[model samples]
Target: MQRQTLRLLSSTASIVFSVLATQASAQMFNSVQLHAAAPGQSGGMLGVAALSTPEYQGSAKNRKLIVPVVDYQWANGWFAGGSNGLGYNFSGDPKFHYGVRMTGDIGRKEKRAKLLRGLGDIDAKPEIGAFFTFNPGADTYFASSVRYGAGNDNKGMLFDLSAGFTESWNRNLSAGASLGASYANDNYMQSFFGISQVQSARSSHKIYTPKAGLKNTYVSAFVSYMINDRTSLSLIVTSDRLAGDAKSSPLSEKTRTSSIVAAAAYHF
Candidate 1:
């Protein structure tokens, strides 16, 4: 009887060992898997195709164009003292995201008449007036202004309103859009549309009028990427649409216009 019991115990022990071995093999086959995360997670292979350019482009025709002398700003509250220009700011806080600016330009004596005549010569004296701007944030800005010129043929007032926005997605990439409109006396209106030969002749003025009339609209977009901490590149494009009396004028080209610019900036 004792011999029979020993045999049964040995058999049971062998069965238990086999079952344990099978489970160990199964666990090895079902090992945990590891995979790579998406590109943005590692700052590699970001899929933004547009930002992959080796060089930068923007609205200034890839040329290092400084902000025009006519639009330079002064102290945080006011911009003044550049060629008969004055500006005041009603709102000064950038963080709270609201402010207003008023700017004015006075007439100047040296009206490049010879150059002005080459375009569509309105031959007007310098103008003076104030513009009001409302900035809600770094992303959005709006403005309206009026000016009066002294020229016998050119003396008239202009009213203009414009708004624009900029957006950034990451530390190195950004985009922007803008729109604007304006109304003014016939001479000022013509000059705005690029039809007034006079304004175009003054390459220094860099002004254009819509052929359609005194009313004009413009739109623009731009994208920028920072290659590094000090160097960056950008691309910009813009379009203008004309309407009203200017469209019927001899200078009216009554068509959509566009421009592309690439630029690189070094931050000091």
Candidate 2:
């Protein structure tokens, strides 16, 4: 079973803890001026938010979900949480970092949408990858990551490249924006966008095969306001467009989708 509700709840708890830990650490150590200049919070932070995203790649329908955002970093570089999962920061310089990590692959479940019918469900699995970040200057960075599925459910490889900029407008207000793109291997394309003979027979769609190619591109922005040192509120907006074979798949309902997320994080 997917245990979607349980997963969301657990993730929420993790994000809350991370938020509190990070906020508390900052207030305890940094001066007010220094805090305002920082790019991101330190230590663990937890956040809870409602997210709206496509029910599946190419689907026009959207699903609103509650998610917990969690991130943590240790002095020695070993840490876990967020999309990066468990990893160690190998670079000694603050401007650059690289590390390997393992993250959970939350595959698609057919129950979420009608378009997924006849396409066999993909199981939750694991992926291992290496990530690198380069900070060109204060509040700006470029990053890339590549991962390969280590599980049977979706044994595919993916690569992502992105650029982001963050700024603190005032002591209590900060914002960031990012643009990114992704590439998927044949396995990934086939699993999510390809139509098997059985699926074609079962559904009203024709059999189709998608090859390896660019998958999607997206742009996102976020703003956060600190209510106090221990708590904050944030809103995020994102828009994405399916490309290559993914856009042509009969399984895909729309070429573009948008999402908004609102959340609060508490630091202890």
Candidate 3:
């Protein structure tokens, strides 16, 4: 019983440690990494996260949000909660993971800033994607994913690639860093960064059209600490720089964005 309990608690901490980052990163931790609880045991992390993120992918404006966290996965490799979205893991490899899921983005809203006054709202759209991840060692991992059906007409697409490493300083602490980039389709680029003729006439910005290319590159670092058997704390910082056509959008006031996240999670 004690062994199972420890496993359950450890599983909770593992999930908590990666939750917020995965929420913002559009990646999913493998089942072996996430569902570590003992057979028939239930230990999922739930908490709150505070974030300061760009209004849009390349927006210079930042917005703050506080949201609740909820996640629990069963033994069958199916789970749903918060930002990781609903998904199922079919891979049984301890070092490799692959799956399909539904993910989406909150499209830009004109009310987000005066700079967007002339640009109309880009309605949020649903996206479906497949993901693959490989853990070559206990401390290193590589992940990639492609999402489609984005944009107003569902013609946009996104591809994400990242690599990372984590070091466990002690039973109670772990730290890691990641480097990644995002690629977008022409439709996706235009949907968010392109300015239409009507928009140019209505807003202060001039008409501009963007092409599909690498949208941004980012670096992230994070540290997590277990406060107790059932609780954990984490802090993550990320900085993103717009690249290719994404950097030259006339609608963009800044080509770089940095964000911070802090949270505490508990297993119940």
Question: How much is 153 displaced in model 3, in angstroms?
Answer: 1.3
What order do you get sorting by TM-score, best first?
A: 3, 2, 1
Tell me the deviation in Å of residue 185 in model 1.
1.9
Instruction: Rate residue 111 of model 2 by lDDT.
Output: 81
Better of 1 and 2 by lDDT: 2
Supply the global lDDT for candidate 1. Answer: 0.37
RMSD of each: 27.1, 9.7, 3.8
lDDT computed for candidate 2: 0.62
lDDT of 1 by residue, 40-146 (tens): 12110111112111011111111222221111233344433222134344444432212222222222222322233344333325555654555554345665656
| Alpha-carbon lDDT, every model | 0.37, 0.62, 0.67
The better-scoring model by lDDT among 1 and 3 is: 3
Question: Which candidate number maximizes TM-score?
Answer: 3
**Model 3: per-residue Cα lDDT at residue 84:** 47
Question: Per-residue lDDT for 54-162 in model 3, tens only?
Answer: 6666567677777777777666666565534567667666477678877666566788777789788888777787788787765677878788876767888888887
Cα-based lDDT at residue 252, candidate 2:
78
Number of the top lDDT candidate: 3
lDDT, residue 209, model 1: 43
TM-score of each: 0.50, 0.82, 0.85
